[model samples]
Target: MPRLSGCAFFSDKIMQAKVDLLHTGAEAMFADLGHFSKKAIQIAFLSSIYPSLVLTYAGQTAYLINNVNDFSDGFYKFIPRPVYWPMFVIATLAAIVASQSLISATFSVIKQSVVLDYFPRVKVVHTSHQKEGEVYSPEINYILMVLCVGVILGFGGGKEIGNAFGVVVIMVMLITTIMLTLVMIIIWRTPPVFVGMFFIPFVIMEGSYVSAVFTKIPEGGWLPFAVSMILALIMFVWYYGRQRKIEYEMANKITMERLGQLLAMPEVQRVPGLCFFYSNIQDGLTPILGHYIKNMSSLHTVTIFVTLRYLLVSKVDQRERVLIKRLGPRGVYQCTVQYGYADNLSLKGGDDLVAQVMRCLKRHIAMSTDRRSSVSTEEEIANLEAASLAGVVHVRGKMRFYVGDDAGCFDKVMLRSYEFLHSICRSALPALGMPLQQRVEIGMLYKV
Candidate 1:
């Protein structure tokens, strides 16, 4: 697939700044939470609750019917009470909670763009904040409360309300799964092969389970499935077109040798280190050097920044992070460096980017050097200090979308994208994926 630059954005200002270990706010947050342990806890909690609730609801109607049949037919006929009503109620509640939470979380996931300014500004309250007795969504809360009161008075209980819950739950799960896939690809920089092999399959399987339930349920169960399918179709078309549009916009900037040269210039010149380059590409192909260079130049070095989110799966090709590709007289392609959307640091939660880049670049260069070696720590420090004082360079350009309207969306997308490229330039070698070049340092040009 051809990659596209969303727009044209470039700058030529350079700042000699220090580089540090902490790359972005999210990284800092993950670090502060002590990393894996916090994530493990979250995964564990979600795993425990999600499947249990889904399964509990799936067989509920069947259990209700079997128990009702066991009771005397005359007893139910005379008073008309189902033996499994209680179980049915409990199962319905469980499903609603799980599915409702899923829907709310979908909103949160999309809201990240809003937080990142990829979308228009809107207020969103964190659920935890509301749980602590804060009036977060006053309008929504009051509307729900009043409707619930109306239902109680009208039906004596939630019989009518309960009937509609199953359909709502199923619709939400399907929609959420679809949304999750899009988010993973667009924002998280998830590889298409991995997403297709592992993630999409799981979603299809879960959807099948939900589908079976809808097929078997007695009270308008199929309604939810129909709605989910309709919504899914609409979203699929919208998202697919959007992606195609973005790619078309970014096409001119996705050159292989050009990007490789951009990465090499700062390091090869050794002109005080910090350098920042920006591009208006949505895919961050510039951020991901391995994929970009491999296709363009056929020079494979250890791709220190290979997308590692799917390392375990087998069918997917496993290229080492550090693949050494020869450039003949140009010398070995020391580091096949590419930076993309995910690597962009400018979108990080409010950070002093210039200072952060300075610190990060210094640390990156230092991490490679051994103090006990010939170079004294004092001298290395002096060099780093001098580099920072020299200031980094910034390159900016006006990216014109090769396709579609020139609304601000194109510029907004590209500017943020370029900023991200700058951020990656500011930071150290990426920590995940294929190993990066040990012999060469990808210098950052820091700018404020």
Candidate 2:
């Protein structure tokens, strides 16, 4: 009786450790929510996936019970001899489809991370014209492929890989549970008792699995932990550096009055055409424009300070996409183009952007109450039309950031790493479809 009790305890622990790996599909489905509607995922899972999984697990358990002595490769061996090969082929295809879904979800997550300034910029290819969430990242795909190959080579067996996967999946579930609890309390405004009702059981269940899997860390579970730490460090450094850079820009930003004074200088020349100055700032003039004025001493007839901002929503209406505000200086306008995560600003051949800008300018002119007279509005519209005819010039900044002399060792290392990542990653120009000949890159270096 004592020996049977001990065996049962050992079997329970083994089952707890391996159960997370089985539920990995559930976590993966959540990750893929961006690619599909919430209703679609919920219905598919409840109606089809849940039933199928329950039946499959029941069949496997029954087979294991009948053949208790045959423990080695029980899953595959349980299948009937006639349909074994066909089932194997189907399982392989299903795995490939699941992998593809996970890959797509990864791309969507990375793109969101970039927008939120938590990661360095990377080339994101929108795979579908209509579905903005369907994206592919060549660089990330290659990185994932290399890492998968490395893991296969390092582990060299299914058991070890399964152990690592189980550890990571359980950790992810625990984190999700914690996040959901916070959301319930803070965002959903649920009562403490209700929150505890959902939280306590999950914490206890997942916490036990966490302890069970910790024993497997030395066996093969350390791989995911190491990889996760490295990625977290990268994200931390990128986010910190980006915040510092933004602070520096805000502190040194050129105001409209300062820009007006610069343009009024005797050496300054007002040339024909429209100049689109790209900036991260939404209101004030960018340091890049100040640099340009100081060096070239030239200004366009009509200048538009352009900033692209991504909102938290999935889509922004086309009618409300472009926002134009006239600045203190004549012919100076702030053009903000707003987009949502799942919104695409298709600037095919760059003509779409130019046309949109022209339309917004005309609308602003018509709506301005401060215009002295109808003649002034007409003159402004004519000037914009003439500038459009003269051609549009896109002025972009090529910026480099360096750490300050008084920075700590950690700050130096992080900033240096961020600089390296920035140097290699793709910029925003290519994605905008800006013409090469019309694009002008002004170089600026900042010590922050």
Q: What is candidate 1's lDDT per residue for 4-58, written digit by digit as tens?
A: 2211111111110000101111122222222125666467447864565455434
- Lowest lDDT block of 10, candidate 1: 12-21
> Judged by lDDT against the true structure, how good is candidate 1?
0.39
Tens digit per residue, CA lDDT, model 2, 257-292: 899799889999989999998898975777878888
Per-prediction TM-score: 0.31, 0.90
lDDT at position 298, candidate 2: 92
The most accurate candidate by TM-score is 2
lDDT of 2: 0.83
Residue pair clashes in candidate 2: none
